[model samples]
Target: MAHEKRAYPLWTELPYAGKTHSPTIAGGVEPDAGKWKTYFIQHSRRHGFKKLDGRPIRLAIKDPDSIDWYAQLKVVQHTLENLSDQEKRIAEYWSAGPPTKQWIPIVDRLIDTYAIEAPRAARILSAVFGGMNDAFVVCWALKYKWLVPRPNQLDQHLATYICTPEHPSYPSGHATISGAAEVILSYFFPAERQKLHRLAEENAQSRLYAGVHYPVDNTEGLRLGRQIGRIVIEELKKDTVNGLPIERSSREFRNADIITRTYEQAIPFDYKSKCDSLLIRDDESTGNSSTKDWIDPKLFI
Candidate 1:
């Protein structure tokens, strides 16, 4: 037996987005590519392909090294099958999907209203998303390090709906990504924090419904995401990124809870319909609405 160092195809990368686990060498046999070709030829003969004179025979010879035509298909197929089976077993200790159910409609609304002020809204949303980028990178990197399997393959009782994604299950990427976005947007519009947080939580849970992640994956993932958001906020207070204001004076900032409560009261839940009434009032858009000085470009660390 001989083995080959085959690179996984790019399309397959999506299913196993954060899996970083490497195979164990153990007493694994080294595959012989030449012998593998011979074996495939023999299998083809057994399957009656040898009797074909035209297209089918030509196809087999032309694609002898392809996975479906050869042994790599079996190797990868069984490896994933085993991993999913094991993941299903692990999913039993906890729930298999989103940790909360209350946030779905909230997020649905937010996503529906993702566009508001055209360019300005785009800029604001872009800045908010920038705060989220680091969270996903770190979370996914940690996921690879943790190398936890997902629930679909681990527990027999947990019937996963999505095809098992080929990623490690630890920190849920969806949860962390959504959480970071929520934290940043919530800072800007404090009144919407609960709704935003719920949205984030629900986004994480959708992965479970999608059958690609487990409940614990979202829980841990959300925790990590919030931590990343806090770190980004602190850093923003001291630095600048591409002309976006990151830092604010201590005098201008309010407690997050108070700011959020006031914002919600001011904006109201049905504020979208009255977009005309939601004017900036003053230069709250320019001057520090919270009494904070714009972080000077020089002071940005």
Candidate 2:
């Protein structure tokens, strides 16, 4: 009861935020994101190229029972057991926060890659980030609805590389949001489709390496979030400048067109890691370890 009582409440005020049980969160929903849906300024059906009264497509988070949980746990175990310091660095980076900040560098990189015009850059970011938020709404709802457990709960002796988020672990929030970002961004920059897709895959995998979420959590989150992203992209494509095809100024944006983030200055988090300092195991099979302080991956977080 000691640790259980100490767990944080993500949003107890909202009805859909759900209830907690056994260190597992249930019945999740982000009311703020739902409120975001009413915001038609960016790309809502009411004010976009498409004028449908409802969402383009419904979310598809499957019933938890349908998942092969044992196999899922095995994958999480494998990733944790085989985790390298480099992989841990990547995972810890994402565990910091959601797309609002952690994603700035990636978006900036894309803008630089394509040299996107200022106004147009604004539109792409609006679509990508808006979709990212939408995906979170669906993902969290499914998370609490499923009320899955984190890897640590299943195995008390397990030590996660990052602090586990205080929510159900069925669908990873980072994976879900990143999945949506990849799809929405790809629609704007099809030339970088492979790279964007790879980023999404890595974002999902990072959850496993963190040892906080299971494999299925990531897989399902990505799948569900991708679907949400497609919906947002479909809405973003409707644009015309004097009957000529173009898209931009779909939402608010930073003034500069070629936005770039200095990674050292852009890290969005600053929490201490829950695990020990740097040490690489000599072998995955034998689980032997040595200790040596490694370089901090980022300055801010």
Candidate 3:
């Protein structure tokens, strides 16, 4: 599929109003989307981990022309019209920059809070960042491959709270990075798993709150990122000194828990429920009864 320009002008007051977006153009970021697919993490070669390839990962989403696709669009429109004050704040907070800008501070905070030593802190940073790099490579590959339009692109009347990104929006970059951060950080700090996951979820949802992505973008992005995170963890487990695996530790503090508890508590939008219900309906229509048949095994791998 070919990437296309936005049908409507950018919501932001900028030169984007008259100009179209092209990654190959002067101001574009990462013009060559496929270049990083074969990049290896720090310990990948040392641990014999195969270079991660994003080309094979496919999202189980409806075609953009299908009824379900429009249904998903309607969800975005509904969200934009009914955005709560909290949701608006969430969008602005995460929109500060690319995912790394926020994640680095989080990692630093965790390292300081736990009083982690130099060696452990180094490992945490390397693993999390490495995993996020791989996740982006994969996410970008699929994004350009699908070339799905932003929610505003599909609906010209729709105006976003934040400026729409130049790249295609199938799987969200922020969600993908957040997912990778959630898994890698949780591995090092299991006590904070729930809190880390909540952060990741909110990061993903923030895209929708900003009216930039379809719900499926966040859902599939999280799944894709988590897969990369698991792969990174597997590679890390193989790193050994004199045939013994390197030390991995977890820590907890009452202060950390108290701080995390202050985050807002509310049910996230259930994007998957509608998709699941449709899958069940298909199962009933067809004679096929095995749930495994519907699942893409590569996603799990």
Question: Which candidate number would show the highest lDDT if scored against the true structure?
Answer: 3
The per-model lDDT (C-alpha) reads 0.40, 0.58, 0.62
Please give each candidate's TM-score: 0.42, 0.69, 0.71
Candidates ranked by lDDT: 3, 2, 1
The CA lDDT at 264 in model 3 is 35
* lDDT (Cα, tens digit) per residue for candidate 1, span 24-108: 2221112111122211112143232221122222211111122221232233234334444333323211122222222233333
> Which prediction has more favorable TM-score, 1 or 3?
3
> Which lDDT tens digits does candidate 3 get at residues 54-119?
233333333333325567789999997887767866775676546666676678878888888999
Error of 2 at 129 (Å): 1.3
List residue ranges in candidate 3 displaced over 4 A.
2-28, 37-67, 249-301
RMSD (CA, angstroms), candidate 2: 9.2
TM-score of 2: 0.69
Runs off by more than 4 Å, candidate 1: 1-123, 156-158, 239-301
lDDT of 1 at 165: 34
Scored by lDDT, model 3 comes in at: 0.62
lDDT of 2 by residue, 1-301 (tens): 1234322222222111122233312322332332345222233444222223453444566667666655676777777777776786677556555434557777887787667888878887777776776677666555654456666655545555554555567788878887888888777766666767877887788888877678877887889878778777666656667886675433323233222222133654444432232223544432323232222322121
